[model samples]
Target chain A: MFVDLLFNLRAQGLVVGVGEWTGFLDAVGRGLATDLDGMYHLGRALLCRSESDFDGFDLAFAKTFQGMEIADDLREKLEEWLRDAKERTEGERVPHEFESMEDLLEAFRDRLEKQKERHDGGNHWVGTGGTSPFGNSGRAANGIRVGGSAGGRSAVATAMERRWEGYRGDRTLDLRELKVVLRLLRSLAHDGPMELDLPGTIDATCHNAGDIELVEKRERRNRLKLVLLMDAGGSMAPHAERVEKLFSAASQMKDTFKSFEAYSFHNCVYQWLYKDIEQLDRVATSEILAKLTPQHRIILVGDASMAPYELFSSYSWPSTTTDAGIDWLRRIKQRSPAAIWLNPDPQRFWQHPTVSAIGRIFPMFDLSVQGLKDGIKKLRVPH
Target chain B: MAEFAQFSGTDRYIADEALMASVNAALVLERPLLVKGEPGTGKTLLAHAVAETLGRPLYSWHVKSTTKAEEGLYTYDVVQRLNDSRFGDADVSNIRNYIKYGPVGLAFDSDEPVVLLIDEVDKADIEFPNDLLRELDEMAFTVRELEETVRAKQRPLVIITSNAEKELPDAFLRRCVFHFIDFPDRERMERIVHVHLPTLGPDLMKAALDRFFAFRKVAGLRKPPSTSELVDWLTVLVASGLDPASITEGDPFLGVLFKGEADLAAAVDKRRGRKSW
Candidate 1:
């Protein structure tokens, strides 16, 4: 059974080699996994090294076990819904009847208990289609979707969420506009002691007609330090291209500062911030704060579009240190008074509850040339 | 293949059941284990713990942004060979004398199943992982300069860690087992703390944990205190002889707890009114 699965995975362009096959057999022989889920996890652990291969591995695994031959059939149905959803905005409604998520959740819980069998297209009960407050493929703008691709972005939550596409660091960005704005944040100080001026030495040497001459003088280095905190994953996926451009531009400003640090976070700043894309090691927020002085400028980049609960609720993220994202933002603001937030979400969507909530704490600008100019100008002002 | 019993006694690591299962699978399968996690969550430590448990010699390759995949196999010293030929030195015609074994090459040439750690692999270029695919899969590589193929006498237990700085190719990922190390919970964190500081007093430990958890609960912090930070704070607390009861008070030691200027200000602001300082 496992061999057949491995063969199928290889056929599907997974590149399962002889070594991996032998290892899979060894795992099964050793009884590392007893059940199907365990086997799935074991297979995934042994087979998939990167997150990009996860989607392919899932399809191959499902096809081999569930005996589903038509892989494209489900995707085609999903694609059809997506196409229809994009074209038809008539069925789009937020169901303003419920005042709060709590009330909707309470009603949803009752319907779930009353539901006895699989339901499809009805006014009530947890199933596909209709104006029901639960399940996928329905006109319920606030429904909780289960077991389908997110055709429409109306769901409060999802069961089978799509994998987050990792950010590509090598992508090229037109930094001309960004560099112009970033230059505003530059603050050069001549007070600090400097080393030998190489360019000055060469000029002086040439002036002396090939005579051995050297110039030793202090050169002004940019005293300003900029800390860029970027948001990644999920909602920020749509704005990746723009964010990459910003990242490329910001990274190029290394020569503009005595010290520059960039870190990536998901949704909100929490216990850990990734220093790099691979997210192998993280420098604690506390450590970052300690390392940077109050004089340093902090720039936050994100769409700031998530459930309000993620910002204010105590149980937003499991096993995290923070009770509320707002508190963290406030803390950051208090430390670095010059901190500014750059929202990739359009100015129209800045009125979003979460975005507005974040805006209240930090001065925000859109992720554009003008927005970046305004943000840099704001950073120049003394706190 | 080694039995499951051989890989036992990994209790010092404090890994969860799922993580342990992944490690076991990787060991049994003889495939490389690719571990990903946020920093300071013990991703690299897993490799060390596994190697220690298996009683295997560990070979580490710390990759930087400029690191090339060829450096892990073998490097031909063309300049040195040319210099030797120019100097009329002995064995100038022998190409094997100029070939130096890199970490991967060393691992393949090992007589036993050594543990190979490729730390922070995402630091390298996009093509780095793909370049290692054939060698990793076949456990061998041909040195074109020497005109000889070197095969592994014993398959090394490869461990690759990524910071998620870059996305690796799907083909490279499919060749290894994957595991993600989540941030340890309070209970697990307590165990980890005890492991590091066994001599910590009960009262101080309780107070410290309380303060740590409370500080972590504060929002909008760009970087929250991690497990290692907590340990570092405790080390400082023990060294300073500060009272744990006064931890909530505006103590200067808050610097150890919150590293960022903003985080420190927030911590100070949260405790007592702004004018109290």
Candidate 2:
């Protein structure tokens, strides 16, 4: 029986070997695992090595023991929600029962507090598969869906959301146009004679070889420091490929700037900005502000389509004392007056309340070549 | 199995209920526990803490971007062998002496169960995790030079950590139990702070936490001070004999709390505004 299970796991792309099979059998024979749960623990211990494989093992385990098919439950639910959403609104603005934002938030908070069990269909409480003004699935004029894709309705807030990965990767940047725009904000300065200009020295030496002259060259460097803050996570996932292209292009322009630094945030510039995508050692935004001087040109890349609360609320889940996203943007702008917000969200959505709110503080532009040119022009003009 | 229960709640480490449960689950199942979290959140330390508490020898493999999966298993010194065959007096026929076992190999060959930590597995190339899948699952690998297969006498308790920089392949992820170590709450932070600075007075501790939380609350600070940073800041405070109340913007020791120049300027700006009032 264990061998069959191991075979099944192998068939499902799990790397189960002879040693793990023997170990599982040994544990079973020794009565280490008598029940299904015990066997699961034993099988998992012997056959798996990394967390990346847990989902696969879970599926294999379920299929072998419970005879249940593993399916994309979340995707299916999202598709169903989309269908329901499409049926509800046929090019008509569905009127909401709640009159104000405060009423909606109040009702949502109350239901969230009382919600103990997962409710599928209800007018109250946050849960999945419900018409309640909370949770995903079912229709509600204005509710905070806990999970699933954005149903393009009155979802005031989304809790524990995965970053969106919906943007097409084929959008290529015109490097010539990019370079022209990027050159406008150059702040070059001569910082004395720093290094040997070998090529220049060689050329000059050969020309004046008859005199055997020693020529000294002073080095002038681009004094401009760039802090590129990228939006990462659920909402930025779709724009990842394009953003990556832009990031690489910017980084490759080694001669354009004296120094270039990049950091990533989720929906907004929060307390922490990660230098790496792994969410490893993040430099505090305050620290970033501290490190960068007023002369530094800051470019923020993000699609500001997050729930307004994420921008306005002081407290978000997982963070007890998070300041509003706009406050962070203001502080960044305050320190680096030359900062520009490069929005990947289309020009049409620039009118979004959250987008407009952020735009009020920092001049917002599209992520396209034209937008880049416009943003550089704005930065060049003094406040 | 009962003895394993005693390894919980070591002075060096304080795991929450959920994390402890995951650890216990990994232990009972005899699978590698893959821990994911932000930097300085104790993903690496958890392995050390577990090894210390369990009294098992810990083997660590610090993975880098250039690290290949084969380096974790064993390395065959082909150059040395070739040199010996051509010029040296020593016999090159016996290749066992030249075969150096890596952390994973050593753990597998051990007589007893040991703890193996693959630190920052995400730093490696995309193929590294996938390459590890077979050896990790089987707990055995074949060394072609020796023409011998090395099998585990005892299954090593493996712990893998990822900073979430890159997503591990689904095939690789499915093989292990997973846990994410979130940032500690204030109460948990108090416990963590106390662990690092036992001699800290209540007044100083309170003052430090207040300042730390205040820095964290600043909206635009890129990277908030983590638990380790907090500890380092407190250590600096206790060492410098600096008064907690006098610790304001422009204080030389402000470098301990904030790493960025802009952050310091912003803090100083805020302080100046307050002073003007």
- Give the winner by TM-score: 1
Worst 10 residues of 1 chain A by lDDT: A164-173
CAPRI grade of model 2: incorrect
Determine the iRMS, in angstroms, of model 1: 10.9
Error of 1 at A145 (Å): 28
On lDDT, the candidate that comes out on top is 1
The list of candidate 2 runs beyond 4 A from truth reads A1-383, B1-7, B248-252, B260-277
TM-score of each model, paired residue for residue:
0.51, 0.48
- Tens digits of per-residue lDDT for model 2 on B21-116? 456656766767888866788898999998998889999999999898999999876556656766787877787977899999999999988999
Instruction: Give residue A22's error in model 1 in angstroms.
Output: 11
Q: What lDDT tens digits, residue by residue, belong to model 1 across residues A277-299? A: 55566867667766766788999
Candidate-wise lDDT, in order: 0.73, 0.70
Candidate 1 structure quality by residue, lDDT tens digits, B1-277: 2345345436567776557678777777677788987777888888898899889999999999989999999987665665566575669668799899999999999998899999999889767999999999899999997789999999999999998666567677766788877678788888888988888888888888887887777755646777878888889889988887766554547777677898887767766545312
